[model samples]
Target: MPEYDEQDPVDISRPNPARMYDYYLGGAHNFAVDREAADRVLAILPETREFAMRNREFLQRVVRFLAVEAGITQFLDLGSGIPTAGNVHEVVQAVHPDNRVVYVDHEPVAVAQSQRLLADNPYTAVVHADIRDHETVLNHPETRRLLDFSQPLAVLMLQVLPFIPDTDDPAGVVATYRDMCVSGSYLAVAHSLSFDYWPGAVAEAVEMYTKSTHPLNLRTPDQVAAFFDGYDLVDPGVVFTAVWRPDKPVSDEEAISSRAVAGLGVLP
Candidate 1:
C-alpha cells in the first residue's frame, strides 16, 4: 500500500452499497446496517447471494484469461468492492508474479480494508476516489506508478456500472477510460441485466438499491454493449454472468437466474 493517512471516516449509520456487497459475500468487513440491507435484498431475491458469487466468478475468470492469454500485466479495477477470494491481483499474480493492479473505490471502509489487505504487497495499491472522477483516478500517483498506459492494460468495471446513473453519462465515463488506454487494451464490464425470467425479483433488487448509496440503473444487453462503443467485443458477446466463459457447464436455468451480464472487449 502507498503511504497515506488512513483516517478516512466510515459512516456506519446508513447502509453502504460496498459493505452490503461484502456482507453478501460472507465477508466480515461489513457493519450491522450493511447486513440489514443485505438481508432485505436476500429476502426480496433469495438468489441474491448466488448472483453476487457468480458475478465474482466471472471477474476471476476474466482476470485469469487476460493475464495468461492476452498477456496483460496491469489492471485497473473500478468499484472493486471489499477484496474477497479471487481478487484481481491474486488471480493474475498467481499466473505471473510481475502483474500489477490498482483498485479504485469511493467507499472509505472499502479502501481502508483494501489498504490493509495489500499492505505487504508492493505490486498492488488502492485509490480512495470516485470512479466517476476519471481525471482523479487516472492521475492518482498509485495508478500512474503501477499502470503503464503506453502498454496494454485491462480495465474492469464488473458489477459496478449499475451504480452509475444515466444522467452521469456512464457511457461517456467508460469511453473516456477506453480512449485513454492504447489499442489492444482490454475492457471487462458486467452490469445488472433484467431478463423475462424474473422481472419481479429484478424490480425488488432495483428498489432496494434505490435506498442505498448507489442506486441501481440496470441496462439491457445492447445498452451495456454501447459502453464499449469503439472496442471489439470478444467471443460469447455480452451474456449472463454464468454463461461468460464459465469453468464448467452452466444450465439454462442457472444462466437465466444469474440476472447479470458481462462482456470483454479489446480496443482497436
Candidate 2:
C-alpha cells in the first residue's frame, strides 16, 4: 500500500471514480475529492496506479493495432473517461487522419472535458450517455454521424465492466453492442480480476469503489471471458492486460499477477 495522510482535506460532496482515475494518471482534471478518494484507494493497493497506467497502455496498443494492422477506421470507446494524453483519437489519428472516434461516458465532467478537448476535431465526438443504455449510445446522433455501421469498428470497453454488476446483465450489455457491429468488427474488453492474483487487496479496493458513484463489481476471468460470446478471441485469449500482444517483453509474474485482465475478439 502507498503511504498517504488519511485525514487530508477532502470534498466528499462530489467524489467521482472518473476523476479519481484522472488523479491516478497524474492528470490535473481531478478535484480535491477525487484526489482524496484515490489516495485512500492507493493506500490499500499501491499497485493500482500501475494497473491503471498499464490499462491505458493496453488501450493505446489495441487502438493502434486496430488502426494500423486491422485497417479499422471507426472506433467506439464506451465508458471513456476524462481526456488525457494518448487518447483514442490521438493514437488512432496518428495512424490515419481519416480515422473516426466516438467516446461515450456517463460522467458529466468526462463528457465536458472531452467536448473541450475535441471541439477542434471534426472526426471525433463525445456522447453523454450511460454505457448500459446501448440503444441510446448506438442511436445517438453523434454516434451515427461519426461511425458508419457498414464498416468494421473497434469497440473498446477498457476498465469499465467492473462497475457493472451481474444483476444489470453485463453480458447482455455486451451482446447488444456485439450484435450491432458488422462482421470483421472487433470488441476489446478489459476488466479487473476478482480473486486469482490478489484477492484481499482486490476486495478492499472494490470496497473503496462501492463508496463512489460506480461500485466495482469485480468478476473472475471466466465470467469476463463469457462476455465475449459470439465473437472469436484474438491471440492469448482473455489474458492479463500486459500480456495481450504486448509491444515489449512482459514477464510471466508481471503478466499473470496484474489485478486486471483484457482481450480482443473479432466478429465472425
Residue pairs of candidate 2 with colliding backbone atoms? none
Candidate 2 per-residue lDDT over residues 1-268, each given as its tens digit:
1222355332347668888988889988777778888998888888888888889889998999899999999999999999999999999999989799999998877887788899999999999999999889999999999999988899999988888888999989999998888999999999988755663476777787877878888788888899899999988899999988998899987786567899999999
The local distance difference test score of model 2 is 0.87
Error of 1 at 244 (Å): 1.0
Model 2 Cα RMSD, 1 decimal: 5.0
- List clashing residue pairs in candidate 1: none
Backbone atom clashes (below 3 Å) for every candidate: 0, 0
Please give me the total number of clashing residue pairs in predicted model 2: 0
lDDT of 1 by residue, 60-120 (tens): 9999999998999999999998989889999999998879999999988889879999999
